[model samples]
Target: MRILFGLAVLCAVVVTGISYFVLYRYVSDVPENKICGNIYIGNVNVSGRTKKEAKKLMEQHLKEDAALEITMKVGDKSAGATLEELGLAYKDIGKVVDKAVEYGKKGRLFTRYRQIKGLEKEKLVLNEGFVLDAEKTKAVIEERVEVLAEHAKDAGITKSADGFDITKEKKGETVDEKASAEMIRKYLNSGWDHKGFKVKMAVKTEEPSVKASDLESIKDELGSFSTDAGGGERWKNLKAGVDRINGSILMPGEELSVHDTTAPYDAEHGYVEAGSYENGQVVDSYGGGICQVSTTLYNAVLYAELEVLERYPHSMLVAYVDPSRDAAIAGDYLDLRFKNSYDTPIFIAAEIDSANQMRFTIYGKDTRADGRTVEYESETLTTEDYGVTYKENKEAELGSMQYAGSPHTGKTARLWKVVYENGAEVSRDVINNSTYEKSDQIVEVGTMSDNAEAAELVRKAIASQDKAAIEAAVAQAKGMSAAGSDNAGEEN
Candidate 1:
């Protein structure tokens, strides 16, 4: 019994010594010489180790698990606590350091867990701002440049004697290159992406040959004129008049006026006779037959369907052209002008024939409305009559203004409306109120008692186109009548 008890005691003492040694070694191995808080292997601090030892140990542990958890403190939280409860992780300190060293060589690198989180936020913000997709914006700016170039080309800058032309140079005083460049730059910097943007452009320019051809046609039409047909100087005078209208160019969208082109009436230009129009009781100086040219161009403009900016009609009946259809120009007071509103270029060709007839033709691309047709209708709206004015009978007495003579009646002024249509009634407009002047009546007073009877016999003779009849009428009337007399005596 004694021997067994001694053996048991010895065994117990040995076991106790072994336990103490093991505890001492474990406590010593954990560094106590450095600053201490908690033991951190990978930012994860566990109690019983110094901060330096934990950091060193963490670097060693990262070799095995590069993605180790990191430990963060919560309010009043204890060290070595569960990271899950604090919504944090203990990241591998050594791995982070290694990664930072690698990426830092290229650019910025995260230092701590907080820094990594901050970097993620910054990346998101940058993505929301300026994008790197320059293809779309670049294309949009390129397209704008092309369109601006085309517009510049169409605004033709021609060299002419009228002035120093500066339109053709790509960069010069007249070129709008700066404006175009700025427009394009502004468009690109407007923060738009043109990933799926589309553009449709139409470019137009006037051909040089077309412009030359138009001028040639005008010259040909005006050049064909002859003067020596009639014995009178009227034909010669008319030829000189037609020569004035030459070498004028009408640009697109420009208006050409008749009064603007006609030369001033002067003896130097061979205008011998002045034109006159009756106003009230007296005749007034006015441009005479210029209305013929104006009216002809007006008809041509109508046929071309150009935009009529302004137009006026003659005050008195004109025998050269239809009364209501005539267009009259009296300097700035009245004008026959039209604007070339078509997209293509247009030229006006005017010709005056030897017969004192004028014609105007417009040349341009055919712009006829394929599916449309126009119709015109005329309607009389109103009429008015002015009292007749009489001329003194050369054969009558001084107080005689009327006698047995052919009575001339005044004409009724009629207002007319012209309607224009295209598939439907486009517009209905009133043209003008046309007035006609009346012819006067006169009676011849003769020395014979049968003066009235003799005057009637003379009237029958005057009615004939025979030259002898006109002479006989004149002789009988003169021999029997006094100035301003109503009759030599009551007419037959």
Candidate 2:
């Protein structure tokens, strides 16, 4: 019995010593001392190394990751962004080390012992966490993307000294920001698996709306009209409206909305307050005298025999057009619209030059006969006129008045769409019967004092029907009286 007991005690002491030593390894191999087996920091097995040794390995890998350059392949071209430029830095080094040491050391005594042994077979991978200057990276990517992007070209035409220069449409290409950002982030986190990695960038393309070939069918002058663009803001408004409609190519069966093209008029958009007909009187407003452009376009469209979708006449007569021939546009309320009813396309070529003349030339296929022609004849049906209007001016003499403008005669007129073949009228159709309101004569009467010289000048102007002479005389009289009154009021 004594011999058997001694063998059992000896076996227990040996077993105890083996357990204590195994447990000693588990307790001592901590992040403060050394990294245990089966631990990895982003695929770099940091097994069985001291704390100092593991840091050296991780720092070297981090530096490698930071030194890598990422190539962004865009189509046939490519650009690159380096980790140093992106401000890439590993931030969770300490945390990763702590976790690596803590692994397999938790749970009860038996569980801890089991895990320490198990770690030899079960590998633990802790990817290196990092932070980056996202804004800087984004800016770098955007700049490179912009350099690689191609802008689209919109269709346009400029009148050259020869015929006309046409611009063809071009497709636009750009980088998809979201996709590129994601791919770049993933590549950067790959632990610099590649020294200089090449990644395909995401790009998008867009097509232009119009093309030069769309207007190829426009080879002939279908119809045309022109009007005198009087000077000042009124002329500017007219020119602006015409320019907006110019170079516009209409596809077959498409309608052009004048309001949609030119609207939201303001001084900010190169428009000024000019004389415009509103209600029954003339007023100053933005895009004034724009009706002249629409009126001119209407006549051209009529001669071209294009389909008129919508049109409205002004309340009063416009000197540029006859009573029944005028077309008016008032914000979004009133609009003048037309359609390209033919199978071919049409181009509206409008211009205003140094001669102060505005012209709109419609270009399209003229299917009419060689001798066939169209004409617009405005016939006066009835005529009426109101007398005159007198307005007092504090600066002008009582008997002497300056003629602001002539009174417009109210009339009922019919616009006939007449077709002439072989120089003879073959058909006549009434297009519109417009009734215009009369505009009263306005004169600024002098309120300062009566002047016989100015009065005689007015009489002579009335007799000879000279408006320029009346205005000149009235201005001279007002100047003379103003000087005289100032002299009289001064101390003598």
Candidate 3:
């Protein structure tokens, strides 16, 4: 019995010595300020290093991850942004390092020793938790995606000297904003284990609204109208306006603004000072004769049976077209707008003939029957007589007379569209109504005269509102001024 007890005591002492040695080794291997061995943070080995050193090493490794590039692609086109640009970052690197630092330095001595040994067999890799700002990620993703998108181009017809040139339509692509945002969110949150990655956006094809086939039906002439555009500086402006408007194609349900098409009427745009009517007097203004172009186009559009969205008549009556048939365009406000009411596209072909006639021909599929014909007629509703106005000129000698403005008769009228089928009148409808203002005849009479008698005679003639009387008085005053000048020379 004594021998057995001694043996058991010896075994117990040996076991205690072994345990004490292991405890001492564990204590020595793990420092108070350093992380234990076999520990990792995001693929970075933080073993046998202090908390500060481990944090630096892990941050360097994560810096590479943050700089990783992610590209959003559509076909061959691509746009890229970095993870850091997307506001991705480690949520709490310090807390993770603290946890790592206290890995084997917690609990009782034996438990701590056991944890250290366990780390030797298996690694304790602490995943650096990540966080991304929702707004930042979404905004970055959306901007990049928008830059990557392509716009669709419709097939259109451009007028050529030979005939017409048909351009092919280009296919376009666009992405769903919500889907793209979700896609980027999922990718960043998941384990993205790469330096760079390409994500194909969820794209959809956008087809052109007007295909080439739709414009094929625009061969026949639906309507043609012409007006005399006299030559000179005003004609130059008219030709420039026509050059801009020629070959314009109007798609179905599309409205064309004449002002928008031929605007910026300045010297740079090939316009010169010419005659234009303003407030009862012919005034010199830029883009003077462009109104004739719009008026001709208006007649053509009306004949084509197109819908006139907006049309404004001149403040005074124009000599080019009848009372209610003219359309005028001034600045941004007064514009001639018309829509292509047909199913097919409408092509505008404008040209200045050798006779100085501005003509506009509209081409589209003529759906009207062969025997059907249409015409427009202007009906006068009321008329006002024009008055005469005289202005005194101080610079003129004695009784000089000059015509300032022409007289215009004011009238209110309506345009009627008459349709005849098989040579019999079928319908007559009022298409548009217009009211024109009566403009006065302006005359400048000389009041600066040394002889009061001559000036008073001229004033009486002007007050009479008679052109013949004014002419006779002006002649008499001129004779008296010539006689007075002769007498003054003789006296000298």
Whose TM-score is greatest here?
3
Q: Best lDDT goes to which candidate? A: 3
Q: For residue 90, what is the lDDT in candidate 1?
A: 27
Point out the higher-scoring one by lDDT: 2 or 3.
3
- The TM-score values for the models, in the order shown, are 0.37, 0.52, 0.58
Predicted structure 1, TM vs. truth: 0.37
Model 2 alpha-carbon drift over 4 Å, by segment: 1-154, 173-205, 388-406, 442-492
- Expressed as tens digits, the lDDT of each residue in 1-492 for candidate 3 is 999999999999999999889797867766788888899886778888898898888788778887888888877888888878877777789999999999989888888888888986899988777666667767875777666778677887876678778887888867765676567657754765646888887777777777888888877788999999888899999999999999788888999999999999999999999988787667889999889989999999988989999999888889889978999998898999999999889999899988878999999899989999899999999999998788777677656767778688999999999999998999999988898889887778886788777778887887887778888998998778778878988843
Name the candidate, 2 or 3, with the larger TM-score value: 3
RMSD of each: 29.8, 12.9, 12.1
lDDT of 2 at 427: 99
By descending lDDT, how would the candidates be arranged? Answer: 3, 2, 1
TM-score result, candidate 3: 0.58
Q: Per-residue lDDT tens digits of candidate 1, residues 1-492? A: 999999999999999888667655543443334322222222234333344444455545433332222221112221221212212222344343333222212222223223333443442110011112234433433443333432222222232345323222122112133343334334323542422222222223423323343332221111121112232334333334444543334556877776676756545766444343334222323334455556666666665667878877555555554445567766578887778776655655455545645556566555565544443233333334343333324354322324443233333343333334455655555545455454333333232323465456455554553445545665656565443255644679
The alpha-carbon deviation from the true structure for residue 348 of candidate 2, after best TM-score superposition, in angstroms, is 1.0
Model 3 misplacement above 4 A: 1-153, 158-164, 171-209, 450-492
